[model samples]
Target: MNRKVIITCALTGAGDTTGRSEHVPVTPQQIAESGIAAAKAGATVVHVHVRDPETGQGSRETAFYVEAVDRIRESGVDVIINTTAGMGGDLYLDPHDPTTFVEGTDLVSGVERLKHVEKVMPDICTLDCGSLNFGEGSLVYVSTPDMLREGAKRIQDLGVRCEMEIFDTGHLWFANTLVEEGLIDAPPLYQLCMDIPYGAPADSSLLASMVAQLPEGAHWASFALGRMQFPWVAQSVLLGGHVRVGLEDNLYLSKGVKATNAQLADRAKTIVEAMGSSVATPDEAREMLNLRPRS
Candidate 1:
C-alpha cells in the first residue's frame, strides 16, 4: 500500500525489439527525445540503452551514450537519468560448439562494461545481478559474481547509485551478498525483472516471493514484459514497490496498437493513480533513491 510510487520509463533497451516497433528509438537524438517525452508524460526516471542508428540493434558505443545523455541533460528536463551497464556481458556461442564465441558475442571484463557509466557519470546506473539465457537463441548473458563485484565497486566509487537488476530469485541472493560485502551502499536499489523468457516468470506469487527477500527499507521497482506490463503496475504498487514502463519492457499501448514511450508512461501514471497512489516527481524520486544531481 505505498502512497507515492516512482515510475521509471525505460526509454530504449538492448533487445531485438527495434524491428518490432517503429517507436523504438534507434539514434541518439530519438532516444533523448523519447526520454524527455516520457518524463513529461509522468515518468520520474528514464532508463536508457542506446542502439545502433543503422542496424537498430543494441550498441555499446560510448559515443552513442554520450550524445543521447548530453541531449537529455541539455533539455532542462527534471528527470533522473539511469543508464544501463548491462551491455557488454552478452555471450553468443556457436550452436555446434558452445565453447566457441559467435558473431553477436560481446563479452568484456566487468569494468570494461561500465566504460560509458564511468565516462557519462549518470545519476544512476544498473548492475545486472547475474547471467541468463538471454532469449530463444544461442545467446546467453554472462554476469558472473566476480563481474558483479567489480562493477558494483566501480559504480560505488563513481558516486553513482547502482540499481541491481535481479532477473531470478538467485540473482537476488547474490545482490544481497553485494550489499553485505559493502560493495553497494546502504538502502540499495533493486529492479526485480520479470517475464524475460527463461528468467523470472511474470507471476504475482513469484513477485511476492522476491519482495519478501528484499533488504529492509530498500528502494525497489518491478516490471513485466509485453501485455503483463500494465498489470504489473498495480501488482507492484499493491506489493509496496515501484513500477517501470516504456519501450524497453513493452511496446504496445493495447492490442493492435503501437505505442510511443510517452504513451506507455502516461498509461502507467493512470494505472498508479487509479490504484490510489501518486507517481513521484523526479526530485522526490531522487530523495527516495538517495540520488544527487550532477553538475
Candidate 2:
C-alpha cells in the first residue's frame, strides 16, 4: 500500500448531469472556482471538462477553456491541471441506417479533439487508450490505433504529460503497446476508469486484474462512479495507486446528499487519513509523478 496517496478531483465531466444536481458548475468562472476550492480542500490535481454555459452540455470551445484555465492559474493555488481530450469522439449510429451518422455525432480526428489542449496548455491531457461501445445500443466511442498514434505524437511534441485512461482490458493492452512503441514517455501515467457501461465493471477482481498489467514504474489512479467512488479511494490506496473523486464521477456524498467538488474532495481526504495514509499536496504529487517543470 502506498504510504502517501495523491487525490485528483475531476471538476466536471462531459455528461448531461447539470440538471441532475444544481451543484454542477456550468460557467467558466464557476468551474474555475470549483477547481480552486477542490485544490484548497486537498486535491493535488483537478481534471477539467468545459461545458456549454447556455445548455450545460459538453462543449469544445477554445475560448471557454482559455477563460477557465486562466482563472485557475491566476487563483494563487497549486493544483495540477488535467484537461480532457476525450471529447469529440462520440459516435451515434442511426438505428435505421448504419452508414448514416446521426445528429448527435461529434466525431473528429484525434488531433482535432486536442484543439483546446493545445491552446490552453494544461499540465496534463487525457489520451483514452482505445475505443469501445460507450454504452448500450449503437453508440460508440471511436478511437482507432492510427488516431491514437497521431494524438500521442502531437502530445509528446507539445511537452505535456499524457494520462492514459484505460476503460477495459483491451484498452489497457493497446496502451501498453503504445508504450512499447515509445509513443508514450517513460514513467507513464494511467487512470483506470471503472464501472463505465459496457467496459470494466466496478469490481475488486477486475480492478486487480487491470492493475497487475500496468507498466513498471507507472504513476496511476483509479476511480468508480456513483456510490462506489469513495470506496474505490480506499481500494486504490491499498493497491498502491492514487485516487480521484468529484462531481464528474459521483454526485452524491452519501445516499442522497448532493456533493460539490470541494465536498467530495474533503470526504476523500477524510478517507485517506482514516486509512492512516496522508494525502499528497500539489508539489508532492508533482515530485512523485516526475512532472515537467511549469513553462
Candidate 3:
C-alpha cells in the first residue's frame, strides 16, 4: 500500500511487566526519554502510561503526566502525545466472593480517570470502549455505558482526539453507539487490540470483520500482543489501517533479545517502508487523524 501510515509507540503500560524487562520505563523522566527516542526513530505518536517511580506500578497522577509531558516538550521532539485514560478501572475481584474487591482493584468513575487528561491536555487520549476480562483472572476492566458516555463527552469537551480502544466486538459496537450519539467527533479513531485473553483472539479475519463494522470515515489501527506485534503491523497496513508497537505490548525485538521503545519504533518504521508505505510525520498524523496541532 502506498499510504502515509501513522506509527504510535506506546512508551510504558500499567501492566506488571517491570519484573519481566528492565527496559520498561517506570519513572516519568524515563518515560519521557523513551518517548522522545521513539519519536526520533520515526514514531508520529507516543502513547503514554506513567508508572509509580517507587513501586513501578501504573499511576494516574497528574504530576507524572506533567513531568513526562514537560520533558517531551522541552526536548523539542515533534511527536503527538497520547495519554492513557484507561487507568483507575482495573477491578481484581475476590475469587470466592466476586462482589468483594481485592487488593489489586483500582475501580473509579470515568470522570476520575480523565483527571490527568484534563490537567495535561495532551494531543490525544484513549477511551476504552467497554468492560472486559482483561487477562486470565477475575480482573474485569470496567468501563460501563454511562461511564463511557461521560468519558467521551469530557474528552470531546477537552478538545482531545479520543482513540476508542476496542478489545472485542462488543466494545466496537458500543463505540459505534458513542459515535452515533454524537459523543465522538468527526474522523473518529479506533484501536483494535487483540489476544489479551478472554477477549478477541489474534485473527486477521476477525480484524477484517471488525474493520467492516467500523463507521464511515473512521481512522483505525490494530495490534496483537507479544510475538504477533510486528506481524500485526503488516496486517494492519494491508487492511488499510495504521500500526502501533512498543514495550507496552511486547518486550522483545527478537527471541531472547530485549527491545527498547526506540528499537521497536525503528523496526515498525522499517516494516511500513518495506511494505511500500511511507510513515506519517507528527503533523501529517495530526492532519489525518483530525487532531489539533501541538500547542
lDDT of 2 by residue, 1-295 (tens): 8878989999989888998999999999999999999999989899999999999999999999999999999988988999999998999998889898887899899999999999999989999989889878788999999999999999989888899999999999999999899998877999999999988999999898899998899988999999999999999998999999999999998998999999999999999999989999877877887777865
| lDDT against true structure, model 2 | 0.92
Kindly list the per-residue Cα lDDT of model 3 for residues 1-295, writing each as its tens digit: 4388999999989989999999999999999999999999989999999999999999988999999998998998889999999999988999899889989888899999999998889999999999998778788899999999999999999999999999999999999999999999999999999988878999999999999999989999998999999999999999999999999999999999999999999999999999999999988888888888666
The TM-score between candidate 1 and the true structure equals: 0.98
| TM-score of each model, in listed order | 0.98, 0.98, 0.98
The lDDT leader among the candidates is 3
List of clashing residue pairs for candidate 1 = none
lDDT values, one for every candidate: 0.93, 0.92, 0.94
Which portions of model 3 show Cα errors greater than 4 Å? none
lDDT of 1: 0.93
- Minimum summed lDDT over a 10-residue window in model 2 is located at 286-295
Per-residue error for 265 in candidate 1, Å, reads 0.4
Separately for all candidates shown, the number of backbone clashes (residues 3 or more apart, or on different chains) is 0, 0, 0
Q: Which stretches of candidate 1 lie over 4 Å from their true place?
A: none
